[model samples]
Target: MRHDLRPGRLVAGLALILTAVVYFGDAGDAWQSPWWVAFPLVGGGLVVAGVVGVIARSARRRPESTPPADRNRAT
Candidate 1:
């Protein structure tokens, strides 16, 4: 089956992965950062917002199922 395309999810996943890589790579270094902590927070928020957006978008659309041929058209 084809997967749903959502930029939010993609962005969040990538951001989190990048964060992990950078955080781990700098483990040996003594450098510290205050603004660097925002990466994970943004990633988490993106994921939540993406899921909510997908749910809302789907909910707003009409169902695609059609009536069977045997069903009467005239009332």
Candidate 2:
């Protein structure tokens, strides 16, 4: 099986999982954090993911330079 790894999706999924964990912890009274923290976390995660995706796309679109072949080679 072949699989492709997407950095943006990975980051976004991690962010969502973290947010859920935070909420779960709060609900279970394990620890307490500002309720607004999740907003920033999720927002920042998405922004970072977007930037990463843009960079990856640009990198993929860039042309790769190959070495020039020798001109004096015998046929």
Candidate 3:
């Protein structure tokens, strides 16, 4: 079976993965992160996801254009 693409989910998933990676690195002492960094990261991700969803929905809702009929074709 085939499924429709969802950009919002894709962005949200990527953002979550990135957040986890950052937190994991910090926990392992690989790097230091400010305590409140995740807030903006997740918030921005959600906002971007929402915008993408809206755009995708609008694009899908638009009617597809058809090519003009040819009048010179032989009968």
Candidate 4:
């Protein structure tokens, strides 16, 4: 139920919107930049963002329990 807009999904959505514009608006000819280029470019960006997001999220996550020896030392 976590509906957060993570980096990967956000990139995917943006890419999809751009694809619609390129294909439906006939922007391909206007831009003269191969429409197919969007897929790989967006895909790569998505991967990079996903990796960075994961690394950041994990770093921000709450720390696990203290070391086992500390735990056994009891209060």
Candidate 5:
């Protein structure tokens, strides 16, 4: 079976992994500071936004078909 991932999902997954690293790595005392939380939060938010953008773009790119009423009527 083949699996395909949307751009947004890919980005979100990466952001999630990054968040885990930041939370679990415990780099130093600095990382434990409140300000350190901002990094992963911002990154995750951006990834989510990216996913939304990808979905929106894909929706817009779909072909528009003539309405059924118009198709049956004479031009």
Candidate 6:
């Protein structure tokens, strides 16, 4: 699959990575007794954002529909 890094995608990825690092690092343990909770929440949010970005991009790129009469008309 071709890799296209849109701005939204990049931001999502960054958010995911940041959260992962925090969740795995000592800071996460200090912030919360359990790391699992924060990890999953942040990771899931990032995934959702990424998916939304992809869907938004796809919708933006979709071609507009034309009526049957317009399709038959000459340029």
Candidate No. with top TM-score: 3
| Structure candidate 6, residue pairs in collision | none
Provide TM-scores for the models.
Answer: 0.41, 0.73, 0.79, 0.48, 0.48, 0.42
Q: Write the per-residue lDDT of candidate 5 for residues 13-71, one digit (tens) a residue.
A: 66777666666656554356354685767676686868676786788563458666765
Candidate 3 lDDT tens digits, 1-75: 788899988998888888888899999999999879899889988889889988898987634563335333444
Q: Give one digit per residue, the lDDT tens place, for model 6 in 1-75.
A: 776557666667777776766766656465554646666767777777778788879876635586677766764
Which candidate number has the best lDDT?
3
Tell me the number of clashing residue pairs for each predicted model.
0, 0, 0, 0, 1, 0
Error of 6 at 17 (Å): 2.8
How many Å off is the CA of 47 in candidate 5?
A: 5.6
Error of 5 at 72 (Å): 19
Residues 1-75, candidate 2: write the lDDT tens digits. Answer: 776567888888888899999999999999998889899989998998898888777876524553345443444
Candidate 6 off by > 4 Å: 1-5, 24-30, 65-75
lDDT for residue 63 in candidate 3, whole number 0-100: 44
Off by over 4 Å in 4: 1-5, 24-29, 66-75
35 Cα displacement, candidate 4 (Å): 4.4
TM-score of 6: 0.42
Query: Candidate 5 regions off by >4 Å?
Result: 27-61, 66-75
lDDT of the candidates, in the order given:
0.65, 0.82, 0.83, 0.66, 0.65, 0.68
Ranking by lDDT: 3, 2, 6, 4, 5, 1
Instruction: Name every residue pair that clashes in candidate 2.
Output: none
lDDT of 4 by residue, 1-75 (tens): 665446656665776676667666565466555657778757776776687678767875645776667755744
lDDT at residue 73 of model 5 (Cα atoms)? 71
Off by over 4 Å in 2: 62-75
